[model samples]
Target chain A: MHEQDTEGVKIGLEVHCQLTSLATKLFCSSPSDYRGKPPNTNICPVCIGTPGSLPVLNRKAVTHAAMIALALNFKIPERMLFFRKNYFYPDMAKNFQITQYDRAGGVPFATDGHITLDSGKRIRIGRMQLEEDPAKLSYDGTIESSTQTFVDYNRAGITLVEIVTDPDFESPREAREFLNKLSSILEHLSVSDLNLEGSVRCDANISMAGGRRVEVKNISSFKEVERALNFEITRQRSLTSKGIKVMQETRHWDEIRRITISLRLKEEEQDYRYFPEADLVPVTLTKQFVQDVKKGMPEMPEERAKRFQKDYHLSGETAQILVREKALADFFEEAAKHSKDARQLGSWLAVDLQAYLNEYGKSLEELKLTPKHFAEMANMVSSGEVSRGAAKTAFVEMLKTGRMPRSISEEKGLKVISDTGFVESLIDKIFSENPQAVQDALKDPKAVNFLLGQIMRATKGRVDPAVANRLVRERLAAAKGSK
Target chain B: MTKKQRQEQFISEKEVEHLAELAKLELSKKEFTKLRGELNEILGYFRLIDEVDTENVSPTYHVQDIVNVLRDDTPTPQQPDMLLEDAPQKKDRFIKAPKMI
Candidate 1:
């Protein structure tokens, strides 16, 4: 798992996360909640850039941006300005994007932050800028073969906080880990639901030591981010080994082709001649504003995970898994309130419940399984009313029909039979019906296991195996003496 | 005047051409040459503003002193096809443009 002379892999990320939690678009009063809305419905005069239209900065977008910065431990500046990033794309209805460029007079919203992964490798955040998103482009065919392109303005002018990180990642896996931790932190802050389509997008810049940088864009998911960077690393290594200088360029990740393709050479670069946006006003956050946002911030993932270990006595790994998702962690806390044993509850949730969720490729929110029902199921197992196996089957039943565990158990008759008299009588009946098993038991004591299995099958996996085994042993001994 | 100082205040024809290309604006050769002089004159007037002797004046980014200008997080209700109807060319509720690169 080692390589020579290719160790100088430097990777940086410019991640754009939409502030979908906001109510309206970034600079306009149009609704920002336009994920599945009809195309062009959410566009307003300000967003559509009609003549004489001016942008009024949405205050909530700035607050969410500040919250994200605070969560990342960024240095929040007092005064932040937006600059027009000039570019030519059909999707950019305004012809220039209103973004933040750190200049002599203007500053980004936040800067100089760091996030440490579980392995304690810290990635330095260069800066965070609050900007407006451009309209989405849908092509009739692939970009290389498309005859026409269509634009959907519904996503136009949405607020996005672009987080730029210093070139600190050494491997693609580390980059993926940083993104996962970052996504988890963002989710914990309720800034944006990263589950939504296009909520978070990343552009990665990768290079080797003394080599030109290649930027890979259009990485649609976290998985693809790792893949693109890995591809770039191998591609760069091969190029360097051949003594060919790597050219500085922008490449697009062909997700369909699973390869990186050069989109524009350095010579064809779009000089985004940035200038301070005159239409929008500068946002000046007071010391009190930053402090207020910090005060209102919820407990972040690392802190919550530590608290889970200390307070609930959960193992570090289990606590980390539970707190990875905000909703799942919340569900665990709610379920812990009803269940008596935290350790047992945590094990079931972390193992069986997680397995079920993974099997269906679903998040906790996607399932109708509530904390109340989950707690009830856990308590039943703790109280010995249901075996662990039966409870798991009941859980699958709960998921398939959205029924409570109790009802599912009752409906499917999977309840554990603890009645000693009922169990003994069932064993007697099994001995009589399978008299050959009784005779075999007299010669070989292990033959009585057949009767035990029959009792279990008759109870439909409800009978505890230990109880069935003991009763079958006693009944077989009596029947053997009579024979 | 020296070339450096002259170029500092005047927008050269080459700079004008670069700006036009960046802005994705098509300009004829005659218009490009004529517009350079016009723009440079306007820039000369702007360079005059740099002559103000405000030794320690804090730069103002916006004319208004408002710090926090935010609207409550709420989605504004609007008709679905209202904006699409305004587009000169549209297909299936999307604004049609030439082939995108």
Candidate 2:
């Protein structure tokens, strides 16, 4: 039987990204760097929702949110309003969460934005709103088996911008691409560091062929988002093929089990009873304010990639690889300023340097290698100061020791043997040592490469193979003429 | 109709039960009936506002005539030990709660 087609799959994502760039919590003066701190240590009267405490919004968070909205092509409202979404959960010390609502005299931070994937598929954003994150709850053991649970209020009031997208994705891969593009855009804005754990979270709603939509929550990473969607699509397909109707419900992605488990359905539909938050006055975003934010915005990944292609004469693929990470692109641009061959430098950084980073299990920041080192290395290879192979060897040494390329090359004797007299003497010595090989070279042209290999082994790749090959051919022709 | 007759039509016992459930309140049978009557009286009082002819008036979101009430993103020193002193149940530095499952 033919496999089920995934063309009818529809996936929409509600992504929550923390505004980690800010120093304090959204509504309180508590520090926002709660990751490594002890539990319940980062709480305050306002964040923990003490009875008499009133919430004061953070000004920088609004600026960061506006920058993000502009980057994603969202429409900023003239005035932004906050609402109280009432719900009962242990994660929230306050019964109601302060969030932005789109209806009932509430205007969200932004709306009607779209991100275009590399495949030219545009994922329309429904709305973007600012809200406070809930406290983190951890069980002593598994949730079902734990005797007690603990709550850490440190994360309770971190500012988060939740972006809800229209159900425009047709497949799991498309959804993954959209997430990657969004993450790159977020990184360029520098509003949130995606590398931090729990910095970005996504809840996906997926359906098959107009079936009942199932909402999957707790997807923690981009890869897990694709995995959960693939698993859900398969589960729904199996149910539909058996003539069973898929139920509309919420599920949790079990990261360890690699499956989506059904969460207990509430007896009644959740009535959030949203109302205007009287504690926080509405924020009026003026045109000048937005333009000021736009002025401070950094060049995004897409624009950077295009600039790389135009200025550096780099291949589209190479430019994309370099620009995927903001730091890597910055490194490339810095090195290109001093390098003789920017195109070669771009390729080396994009391909070889990335491989070294992966092999050593290190990020670019952890490496001692600087842009000056990269520029020097690229210039050496282009100027025939060192063979590409010898430069690669020196490159590894530089990665390990953080030394300059010139010093590493000098210490390792990796510089190309450009002296004609020195190379001729080495070849003559090789001809005397391997007389049998010399005879073979005179008889068969292919044997000349064997003599060149011997010279390379002696010099430890210090001699350029091209120069050695030319010298070997000239000496062999002279010997043949003499015979 | 008398005010008492009109107030009785405002809130029902079933609605009171639903509200009690939402608020996590455990109301006895007598309490439910008494609370329902009290809630109806409160609603009847609010109904008097409907008599005003204010069609063009905008809804008031906040009583204070202010906008952009915000602070800089700077952290102040916090006393976690002092803050955790008010918790009824504590485990180490965390606030311990009942098993969710």
Docking class of 2: medium
- Candidate number of the best DockQ: 2
Name the weakest run of 10 consecutive residues (lDDT summed) in model 1 chain A. A1-10
Error of 2 at A462 (Å): 12
By TM-score, the best candidate is 2
**After superposing candidate 2, which stretches have Cα over 4 Å from the reference?**
A1-5, A351-369, A372-377, A380-483, B4-8, B12-14
Per-model root-mean-square deviation over C-alphas: 6.9, 5.8
lDDT of 2 by residue, A337-436 (tens): 9998998898789988889988777888898578998999899998889988788899888888889989988988888997888899999899999999
| Model 1: reference contacts kept, as a fraction | 0.74
Q: Once superposed on the true structure, which residue ranges of model 1 sit more than 4 Å away at CA?
A: A1-6, A241-244, A351-483, B1-9, B64-66, B75-86
lDDT of 2 by residue, B1-101 (tens): 36565646588777777788778799888988789878887888787888899899988888999999889999999888887999889988989888865
User: lDDT at A303 for candidate 1?
Assistant: 96
Please estimate how well model 1 matches the true structure, expressed as its whole-model Cα lDDT.
Answer: 0.83
Which lDDT tens digits does candidate 1 get at residues B48-91?
68879888998877777766555666666665466566788998
Candidate 1 lDDT tens digits, A382-472: 7778877777788877777778788887777777898999998887688779888778877897877777778767876788877877777
TM-score of model 2 (CA atoms): 0.82
